[model samples]
Target: MEILKGIVLLLLVLVGFTMFSLKMPKGMKAMGALAGAATASFLVEAFHFYVGGDLFGITILRDLGAASGGMGGVAAATLVALALGSSPVYAVLIGCAVSGFGILPGFFAGYVLGFILPKMEEKIPDGIDLIAVIVIAAPLARLVAIGADPLVNATLINIGKIITQATAQSPTIMAIILGGVITVVATAPLSSMALTAMLGLTGLPMAIGALSVMGSSFMNAVFFHKIFKDKSTTIAVAVEPLTQADLISANPIPVYCTNFVGGAIAGLIVTHFGLINNAAGTATPIAGLMVMYGFNSPLKVTIAAALCAVAGLTIGFIGSLVFKNFKIKSVAEVRGTV
Candidate 1:
């Protein structure tokens, strides 16, 4: 049940945001805000140990983490408000005011309110519009935040439990599914590290995730090499694919399908060998392989990582042969330079 909730939320963010952004200017800005928010959250999460400290049992760092999360919602709301023709000051103020609830809730509230406020903006007289927005939209958004709080908390708990249980009960199947999912998320604008951390994925599960991401990169490098013949671009994509979002987005069908195949293979291998990664930032090739070395023999881990790459390459090659629909655009078509 918890897993279902998590999957639903993931789909909402991925599909909902994508559909909206492609259709509206405000939606694009909202996505940008979300990306920015994810970055902020990732930084805070990645360095919590040094920046967050316990003094007098105050839990300052923890609060900072929460506040950072809220700021992401604030940023998203502010961008959407701006796109809705609200004044900069008004948008920022309302965003901060409503986002006090928390990140996920604040985002949904702001998104709902942002969407509504624009329609009403044209009806109100200019002099009173700002005040009306503040009075009406702010509280309504907060209400949404208040309403979603329980569901969000419950979803998080269920997601965590679902991941824990799946990894424990059916490691192989979970590896295939979770690996594909994690790789997909990692390649997107959002941070897989943050997602993994939020889901409390550690040990063997973490290893599976890390290797899966790397495997996707491996597949990408091969597919890209065949397309562009640029070793540099292939290497860059292997490290982190989002750097080439324009290119990757153009061929998402092939990229993702190949990634799923590669990642599932990697997941199977790592889980079968009982490999693990107990550290962050392992969701890439070098870092992920290094994480394995932290717990296992260097030679063994190196070989395993190599095999993971091979799996990705093999699957990717097969996908290229089978999927004739993969449309590769010339570098100029993507309109972005790598």
Candidate 2:
């Protein structure tokens, strides 16, 4: 109880600090608000896990996934809702639906939905910056996803099982790798994070870890590539939102080319390392990393992350070249003609 109170106080302080920061001319309001809320949410969920585990049946790991996913979902839902002139209730309902099964899904349910809802939002007269609305929704998104996960899980599992049975292989990759792919496969209509979380539940962290090791520089490459190769102001801001799809949408050839190189390198390193995703519901390397940072397999985990970076960078480099030869120029052209 004492620990819980301390945590609450800390979170409240962070929130208050963030609120105050928003008044500053140089302070980044969105990032500050998110940091504050995330700190609070993290503390709240952590306490729930530490103290309430026996009583509430919450695992610290899963709880992390739920909280983060819920936060992302709520934010995304609210953004989509505001952008599309829909009710927050409905947006949150769908956000929960996106959070199906595990933590990654919970987080991503909102992300993919943000993309999907923009078209609808564009239909409305008073639509706003989808990202801004998402910023508003960020804190509560994960909670919404957590609340809606049971229904989402049931439906996703049925679908995953059916797809697995129908197809020879399932697209079950870990949080980062799979998340990267989902980030690429913009039209697949799958929730990237949600799918990754479900896969995580099946105990594939080693594989994911391996890939992360293999593609450690994937995000880094994104950073470098944007700084070097990308020529657009609108698309260059990839790291801020952690979105490659938007880049692809803005300048498809460069992004597409980058994906192939990045993905291939990632696949090779992951397969070579024989590492798999840890069996957490949300397979973000960050999550497993936090849990086992100083644990028994720290070195191996680090290696796996390095490989993931390699995978993403190598694939991005090569894929970008390939994009130059592709039939379409802009992502809009690719989609519009299709």
Model 2 / residue 233 / CA error / Å: 5.9
Worst 10 residues of 2 by lDDT: 185-194
Number of clashing residue pairs in every model? 0, 61
* Alpha carbon lDDT at 233, candidate 2: 27
Among all candidates shown, the one with the greatest lDDT: 1
Query: Cα miss at 178, model 2 (Å)?
Result: 5.6
Q: lDDT values of the candidates?
A: 0.65, 0.40
Task: Output the number of the TM-score-best candidate.
Answer: 1
* TM-score, every prediction: 0.66, 0.45
Residue-wise C-alpha lDDT for candidate 1, range 1-338, written one tens digit per residue: 54454445555545654576677556655555554544555345323422342212237765764455446556655665665566677667667766655455655666677667766677889879888877887778778778876776676435655675667777776777777877876666555654564444567777888777777777877777776567777888877776777777776777777777778888888888788765443465554554566466667667777888888888877877766555677566677554
Q: Which sections of candidate 2 miss by over 4 Å? A: 1-83, 86-154, 159-180, 186-191, 198-202, 205-244, 250-254, 271-296, 320-338
